[model samples]
Structure formats: C-alpha cells, structure tokens
Target chain A: MSYSDLYRNAMEKATARDAWKAETIEKITAMQSSHKKNTSVRHICFTAFRHSMVPLASAALIALMFFYSKNDFLSPSLSDSSNNTPYVAAFSANDTASIQEQTAPIGRSRSIAIFPNIVEAPTPEQALPSDSCSLDDAVVSTEQYDQAVALLEAQLMEQSQDGTLPVVLTKSDIVAQGYFSANDTISVVFALPATSMGENLYYVYEIPLI
Target chain B: MEAILSPADAVEVYGNMVFRAAFGIVKSQQDAEDIAQDVFFSLVRTNPRFSSAEHQKAWLLRCTFNRCNSYFRSAWHRHTTSLEDYHNLPFTPEETYVLDTVAKLPVKYRQVIYLHYIEGYSTAEIAQLLHRNQNTILSQLSRARTHLKTSLKGDF
Candidate 1:
C-alpha cells in the first residue's frame, strides 16, 4: 500500500470513543455552570468559609487575642509563664515532641492564654470531684456553653496566627474532664479535624485561671 | 478578532481532531481525552478570539500538542505510567498496524508524521503550529517516512 492509502485508512479509524465524547461534553457543561456560580462573591465567600472553617476560627481567635492582649483583659497572671508547663514545652517533651520542635525553625510567634470564658464546669456525673474543688460542678446550659465555645474558638484563631493549626478545639470536639481548682486549671482534650491531606493531630490543654 | 464560533460549537467541531493530535504523541487514549477536556476548558475560560475556523482549529491543535508535551515532561507522569496497549485500540488490524508503527517513531517524528499524513496539515502549517522552522518539520517528516518505510517494508 502507498503512504497515501495508509494515511486514508488510519484517518478513517482514528476517532474518539463515542461514550467518552458524550461524557466529556456533559462534564464540561457541568463544570462551566458550576464555575459560573463559583465565581460570584457570595458563593466564593461561602465556599471559602465552609472549606477553611478551621483557618477562619484560628484567625478569629488570633484577632480576639490581640484585642484582649492590648486591653489587658488577659493579665500577665494568666500568661504562659504562670503555668508550670508551657503547652509547647509539654508537647516537645512527649513522644510527638517533633511536632513542636519543628515549629521553632518556622519562627512563628507564640502565646498562651488562660481563658475565663468557660463559666460552667462538668457535672459531678461527668467529672471526678477532687478534694480541692471550690467551684460548683454543673453542666453548662447549651446556650451558655455555645457562647463560651465561640469565645474560646475566637481565642484559638488568635493563637493560630503563628501558622500552626494545632488541634482546632471547638465545642463539639472538646471533652471537658472538668476543672481542677487546686491549681486553678481547666483540663480539656480535643482532636484536630483531619487536614485536607489527611493528617490528624490530637491535643490536650490545661488552661489556668487568674 | 472575536471568536467565530461558540465554545460548545468549537468543541463539537474540533474535539476529535484535538484528541487525535494528543493521542498521536502520548499513545494514551485517557490522556488524550484529558488533554481535549483541558483544551476546551481553557477555551471557555479564556474566550480567546480567532480569525477563522481554521485559526481556531490550529490553535486547539497547538494547545493539545503543548499539553501532551507537558504531560510527558511532568515528573509524576515519568515516574508512574500505565499506558494503554496499541493492540487494544478500537481499530481494524491494518489501522492498528499503521498506528503501532507511528507510535514507535521518535517523539518529534511522531507529531510531524501525524499532522502531515493523517491530519493532512501541510509542513508549513505543522511548523507554525509547533513554532518550529519549516525546514525542521520537513526534516522530521522525511525521517519519519523513512522509518515507516523500513518498518513496514512490504506493506509500504
């Protein structure tokens, strides 16, 4: 066969898959419409807020911290040094010490706050009553708990400005083991939601009171 | 110049051509389909104006070729590959034989041969689409034809 004949034969056969063409067109249309909608300011803002809830929360916390720090709402008595163990110091001494150790090189500004935000403690059924208990152990009403959680979340957003997304502590994610009055500390355990790339980190914080 | 055809109409007219151009170089149907989608997606996003239908087709073909080259250059594609076999193509035995022969040619020759013989694009057109000197395209086409002639001695 001549090259001309071969070209004719090959051209005749080199067609795209029928099913793929239909599927592709459908996908393109869907993407175009979604892209159109996604470009709107409201849609973009909503999508961003939905996807980066953790980051947003962290930002709010940082802003609130700046406000509190500037106004002396969070006194020096409740600073990181007042606590016997710093959160980072404790984290660095544990098995996952590397997580905190790596932060030093990143040069992120760090601060610790003792929030008096939580007005209620865990109930007796939820927490063990210690001999030094002075505050009443009561389950906070859902509304009060939510308000306190929002305040704490805002505080956390402030703490995250150093670019560390430490466990995103939210009301839903926290398990309040109750407050200890002896050292004026509130112990809480929380887990960070898995990152977009699927990394999950758990954390515990013992917030002190002035 | 403003685009002569709508995005959907352009894709309908030139999608197969774009797919074939991409498939000619990549030797992968799935990758070719992806390149076609990207070409149209870019068209919709950029809404570039073309002087005529022929200009639009050439532009689409050029984009397909560039995307295919980029796919080959990508480290991820280089490290991991799951290419579809030539025999598995939906073509008659003779057509498969021709394509398999074409696929075996060097990358430069493969593109020149496809555009020249199958797609019926002239050497000058191919060079312009690829942004190469016409002499370079002519040289690649000559080398490709010789290789095909030798590989399919009796068939040619």
Candidate 2:
C-alpha cells in the first residue's frame, strides 16, 4: 500500500478504539457543575474588587493632599505669603527707627559721629610710650605671647642674614611651615552662629603669598 | 442570542465535550474532569454572552483545551504517573485497551489525534481549538497516526 493509504488505515484503527466509561462522564459532569458555580461567584467578586480600587486610590490621594496642606498651615516658620506680610511690616518699622537714630543731630549723642576718631591723632610722644609698653611686655612675659614674638624675631633675623632666605629653603618652608614663602597660600573659613530662622553663616577666604 | 443556558443544561450538554477535550490533552480522566468543571465554572462566573449555540460550544472546547494544557504544566502533573493508567481501570473492557494505548502516546501527538478522531473535529477546527496553525495540526496528526500504527501493529 502507498504511504498515504497506510497512514489513513492507521488513523481509522486508532479512532475506532473505544467510548469513554459512564462513571468517568458522570464524575466530569458533576465537576463541571461545581466549577460553574465557583467561577460565577469568583468573577463577581473580582469585578467588585476592581470597582472598589478606584475609590480607594482616590480617597488615599485626597487624604494625602489634605494632610499636606494642613501641615503647611500649622508651621509658623514656613513663611507663606500671608505669614511674610507681618514680618515685612515689622522689618520696615525697625528700618524707620534706625534711620531716625542714624540721621539725628550729632549734639544729641556724641557717640553718633560716623568718623568719631578720625579727627583725633595720638601725639608722637604717646605713640613712643605705647610701643615701649608693648615691647617691654613682650620681652618680660614668660607666657606663650612672649614665646611667639621671640620666635618671630629670631626667624626675621635669620632671614635677614641669609639675604633672601635661600630659595629652595623658602619653598620647603612654604610646604612644611606654612610661612611667607613664594608659593605659600593661606585659606581661612569663618563660621558664624546660626540665625533664629535656623540658617548658618559661612565665610571663606583665600590669602595669596605677598 | 437567547437567555444564557442554565448551569444545569450546560453541564448536561457540554460536560462530555469539555471532558473529552480535556482528557485528550491531559490523558487522565480525573484531571480531564477537573478541567471540564473549571471551564463550566468559568463560563458561569464570566456570564459572557454568546451569539449562538455553536459559539458557546466552541468556547467551552477552547476553555477545556486551555485548562488541560495548564494542568500538564502544573507541578503536580509532572510527578504523576502516565495517564495511560486511566483507561486501564476495570471499566469498559473493549474500549479501555484502545483508550489506554492512545493515552500512552506523547501528549503533543495524542491531543491532536483525540480532537480529530474522537471529538470529530476537522483539522481546521482542531487547529483553532488548540490555537495552532493548520499545518502544525496536520503534521501532528500524521505523526500520531505513525506512532499508533507501530504501537497497535500486532493487537489490531
């Protein structure tokens, strides 16, 4: 027989084999009935769940917005538009008082002069006495102030004797001793106290070699 | 078109159809029955309106096939013995041996053969039910015939 015919014959035999048992059919039918019941209920439940999700999410979003707005209103320091108005009024009033005090007649308070000390110059004799006092105090004290002055003076004398304080030696001093060498730079950071509004003040300074 | 089929009528008419389709793929009567029930339950739960009786029938068959395929992939299914034993039970002696033999074939070939022959589906119908191309159904059917021929050679 040809391959096609043989194939057809095999198929026919395989299919003609048997009917399913009665007990099996009954069992399947019962299962189908129960499954139908369960699926119907499950689908209804799923639909209900889906419907509720939208309202739940909306409620959550509304609650979040309400709480956030409430928090903003409660904080006295937040500086909302309304809150800043009073602060601006108080600042302007203070500015006006300060202006009055600054422009008042000099006769009202001798301390109010802008250049109070510019007209007063110490006599040469007074300058000589103050300089001697500072020098004598430095020489006689056994404190750290005396030690620092003595060290500075010794360094200056040694520098003068070396005629330019050795170029390579100055470079080394700049790197190690942080002194007044060609390459030396000084950095200073000034940290002020925190303001009442909880912000800090910072100043950074970079001083190049002279 | 008409009001939905009552759960009772659906069970009476389509239960066997669904079961056979499930059995064709799963091989075991128990798993097939379970799949059949699940399909009917899904139908009742979804309450999807059908255009005609034919559409309902096709839907059940499709659902049954899907459930059976899911059963095959389940962890429990992998550990179970071959569903060949389902037909070997002490019921319906004449047909039992034949079914047992068919069940012994690999799942891929056996499913196409059962749908084509026992379920009386056309190649195109089987392809649609299994969500396969017509060529794939044809090839599987051809392979199944070859396997059955060798298996049933002396007995037939």
Candidate 3:
C-alpha cells in the first residue's frame, strides 16, 4: 500500500479507539466535585490573605510609630548626664572663686542669712593653690553653704548656652582629635564583647561618615 | 425566558473537546477519562475567561496535551503494558495492526503522525500547537511517515 493509504488506515484506527464510559465518567465527576470544593476553599484563603496585607502593614506601621514616640519621650533623661556636663563644670569654677574671697575671720552671734543669689564660683584644677587655708571655715554655716551651691548651679546653666564650657566633648571634636582615621569611604565595624545574652551576640552599625 | 446555563452545561460542551484532544495523545479510554476530569477540574478552579467556544476548545486542547505529556513521562508508564500487548488481550481488535503500531510509536513521532492524519491538522497548525517552527513540523511529519512505512512493510 502507498504511504497515503497507510496514513489513512492509522487515522481510522485512532478515531475508533474506545473512550471513557458511564461508570468511569461517574467516578471522574465525583473526583471533580471534591477537587472543586477544595479549590474554592484554597482560593478564598488566598484572597483573604491578599486583602489582609494592607491592614497588617498599617498595624505594623502604627506599632512602630508608638514605639518611636515612647522612645522620643524618654530620650532626654538618658542623655541628661552627658548633656549637662558643661553646666556642672561651670558651677565648680564659681564655687572655687567664692571660697577664696571669704577667707577673713567673721564676728559671732549674728545669724548669717544666705541669699539665694549668693553664688560661689568653682575653680579649675590648674588655678587652685595647694596651700591649706581657713576659707572652708569662713563659709561653714550649713544654710549659707547650701544657698551658695544652688545659686552657683543656676549661673553655670546660663553660661552653657553657647556650649563653651569644656566638660563633655562633641562627636565632631572626638573625630577631629585623631581618635579615628578619616577616609572617603564609609564603613561599619561590629565588636561583640562577652555578655549575658549569648557568646555570639554582636552589635552592628553602619557609619555613613568617613 | 432568558437561558441560564449551569456549570455542568459548560463542562458538557467543553468536556467532549477536551476528551478528543486527550484521546489523541494517550490513545487509551482510561487515560483520556483521567485527563478530561483533570481539565474540567482545572477549568472550574481557574474559571478562565474565554471570548468564544473556539478559544475554550483551544485552551482545553493545550491543557490536555500538557497533562498527557506529563502522564507519558510518569513512572506508571514504565509499569504499564504497551498498546501492542493490549492488542493481544481478550478485547476485540477494532483497530488494525498498522494503526496500533503507529499509536505505539515514541511520543514525538506519534504526535506528528496523529496530528497530521487523525486530526487533519496542517503542518503550520501542528507547529503552532507544538510550539515549533513550521519547517521543523513538516520535516518531523516526513520522518514519521518514513518510519511508519518501514515499520508496517511486512504487515502490508
């Protein structure tokens, strides 16, 4: 037989092949029913998850904002010691000057009224003499000494407006003093000290300034 | 009254087309049934939008072909007896030995032969369906014919 005749016979045989009958159709329909139900449930779950994405993101954002605001409120107290170091230095300077001026002997029986404005300036370590004197005794009254210390604290706070009191160093000054090398490229290094959290615990930060 | 077709009506219309397409590949009643059910289940789950009946038919054919290719590659195929073995069994041999031989050819050759003869699809149409160049499909069809002629020489 020719090739065309052979191909024609093949087509007839393929077309005449047995197909699925009633019983098999019933089984397949049943399988499809279960599959349809399962697929519907899966689609519902996927859609619900997709819809919840926005609200979930918003809730996370709100939580982040609350945490940041609470931290903002507590920030000043943690930083107070470092921030007020300049004021403390100025107060000590005023106290030293007051002590040197009050070195003379005083008359008895008269009550020493310490005014609120009587501030004794503190002396710097370099300016203070090593010699022992009766300067401490001259301002020995407890009430007067307390009043003088309070007034001196107020004066130092006013002097700290321009931040000229050399008590606490700024970050720029620390960098400028050659404590760290300056380069064009920024880098971050993390050092993990032995601590209670874990042996492998490490703190990491990216320093944007070189 | 306006006619409202149920999901079952949609399946009945499309299911036959899917069965024909699947039967083309598997050449078995049982395998075609499984593939048809799978195609119907996929249609229901996806709820794919089709512009017309022609589009739906094309989609079913594409899906059925994919499922049949996968089934052909599966481990079950290794365990199953060949179509040649099926011919010698108790069932009446409605299909001639020549046709059976062609059906039992490797999937690539069988597909080209089936599309060319049984489906009456042009080389371009077969190329489009198989995602091959027209020239490649024509060459494949030529090779399949030569192979079939050589195989069926003694029987003819």
Candidate 4:
C-alpha cells in the first residue's frame, strides 16, 4: 500500500474524541466571561478614578493653601513662638531684648497697636480699647502719620534750639528705629526708654534735627 | 451573510489534519491531541481574518509545526520522557512499520514528506508554508525518501 493510503487508514483507526469540541467550547466561554468580568470592573474603577481626580486635587490644593497661610509653610521659629507664647516683633535692631520683653504684653492686648500706622495718629489718650481694634478696620494714611510726626518734630525742634527742652533727650537709652527726611529737616523716630520718658507705653516722640 | 466555514468550524474540519501532522512528528496520540487543541484554541481566540480557507489552513499548519517543535524544546519534554513510544494502534504490521520508519525520520524531513505525500502540497508550496528555501525542501524530501527506502529495505 502507498504511504498516504496507510497513513489514512491508521488515522481512521486512531480517531480524536468527540468530547474535544464540547471542551473547547466550554473553555472559550469561561475565558470570555472571565475577561468580561475583569474588564468591566477595571473599566469602572478607572473611570471613577479619572472622574474624581480634579476634585481631589482641588481639595488638596485648598487644604495646602490654608496651611500655608496659617503657618507660613510651618517655619520652625514661628511655629514655636506662635503656640500661645505671644507674637514677638523686632523693633530696634540692637534693642532685641526690650522688644521681646514688650512683645509678651502686645499679644495679650491685640489692640495696643503694634504697628505705628494702626491708628489715625490717635493720641495715646484716644487709643482704642484693647478688644475694640481690628487690623482690617481701616487703613491709616501715611500722610496723616507724617503730619502728626511733623507737628511733634516742630515742637521738639523749637523747644530744643532754645535749650528749653533740655531733659527731652537727656536719656542715653534713646534709639532711632527709623528716620525719614521732610521739610529740610530729618524726622527721627526716636524710641526713648519708657522709664526715662516717665510713661509706661504708647508714645511717639518724633524729634527733628536742624 | 455567514461564511460557509466559520472560525469555530475550523476545529471540526482541520482538527484531524493538525492532530495527524503532530502525531507524525511527536509519535504520540495524547501529545498530538493536545497540540491540536492548542492550535484550534488559538484559532477561536484570535479569530484572525484570512483571505481564503486555504490561508487559514496554512496558518493552522504553521501553528502545528511551531507547537510540535515547542513541545520537543519544552523543559518538561527534556527532563521527563516516555521510555518507549508505544502507539498501541490497531494497525497491520506493514502499516505500523512504515509509520515507525517515517517517525524515525528527522522532523524537517518528516514534515516535508507528510506535507508533500499525504497533504498533497508541492515542494515549492511546502517551502512557502514552512518558510524554507525550495531547493532545501527538495533536498530534504529526496533525502527523506532515500532514508525511508533504506529503512524499509526493498519494500519501500
């Protein structure tokens, strides 16, 4: 017999089981179902995650902004001092010890007006009550403060040139925080020791030099 | 509206051809059946578009060759093996000897012989399907015929 003839006869005797068709169909069905289930779940999760991304990022950004404004990125020195300890502000460059000493009572007042321009140059007598002042109430005009400073300067210059205000600058503890030029005179913002000035606090004695 | 032979029908039609081709190379019915199932499973899974049924047949035959070769190269095939290639087929002595001698032929030669003689593919067509040179396939077929003729003595 020929090789093909023999191979054909042998293959006829060694037939494949008919169960293979059913088995293949079953496997294909199971795989399709599993693939569909996995894909659906993964698709839904991915969709949800993509949708929520913007809102989540916005919330995180707002939270970070809040924290950043409140604590200035959590600077070590500020965090330590802000913890009910009081707000410390540096005044005179060399008078650090006294500024720190004064800082303790300033936070307790919150209305004592740490910033010189906090008031409309209100006389220390017309100073607002400790709880009545707000940092955002109204802006203090630089011109108004300068005018009040100028008035004080003229008085000091007139009295000092005639040597009538001899005790005005008798104390060696006076320190100038800042100075500015106006009207051909230097307006010096001199901080005299409260004890030397015979006053406890809240006085702006601007002296002008001729 | 529907193809005469759907992708699923490929199994029913070409299942025996793939099985027999694998059987010729591996010389085991169980392995041949496994290789056929894998080939058809790939067909059903991919559902690849073919220009013609002959294209699909050629693709299946190519997959059969790869699957059979992979079986031989598999670590499982390497480490553990059947000591005897016992067919246990109900065949006449002559048919069995012919099959045994063909099985003993190198896989390339066996593939060429089976495709040419049994599957009725020409040398050039076999070369195209196997991705081999036509002259190389012709040489292998010639050598395979000589070996079979020697193994079967004058009977071949």
TM-score of chain B of each: 0.90, 0.81, 0.74, 0.92
Candidates 1 and 3 compared by DockQ, better number: 1
In candidate 1, stretches whose alpha carbon ends up further than 4 angstroms from where it belongs are A34-210, B1-3, B154-156
As for DockQ, the candidate ahead, 2 or 3, is 3
Comparing candidate 1 with candidate 2, which one achieves the higher DockQ? 1
Model 3, A26-129: lDDT tens digits are 54444444444434433443233234443443344343323323322222212222211110111111111111111111211111111111123233221122
- Candidate 4, residue A136: Cα displacement in angstroms equals 68
How does model 3 score on DockQ? 0.04
Model 2 DockQ, alpha carbons vs. true complex: 0.01
Better of 3 and 4 by TM-score: 4
Point out the higher-scoring one by TM-score: 2 or 4. Answer: 4
Colliding pairs, model 2: A32-B37, A35-B41, A36-B41, A39-B45, A40-B45
Best prediction by DockQ? 1
| Total backbone clashes of candidate 3, pairs 3 or more residues apart or in separate chains | 11
TM score of chain A per candidate = 0.27, 0.23, 0.22, 0.22
Clashes of each: 6, 5, 11, 0
Error of 1 at B57 (Å): 0.5
Model 2, B24-134: lDDT tens digits are 567566666666666765564345678777678878877776667767776687887663545444444445545656767787787777666666789998888778999
Clashing pairs in 4: none
Record all residue pairs in model 1 with backbone atoms less than 3 Å apart, i.e. clashing: A58-A157, A61-A154, A61-A157, A61-A158, A62-A157, A62-A158
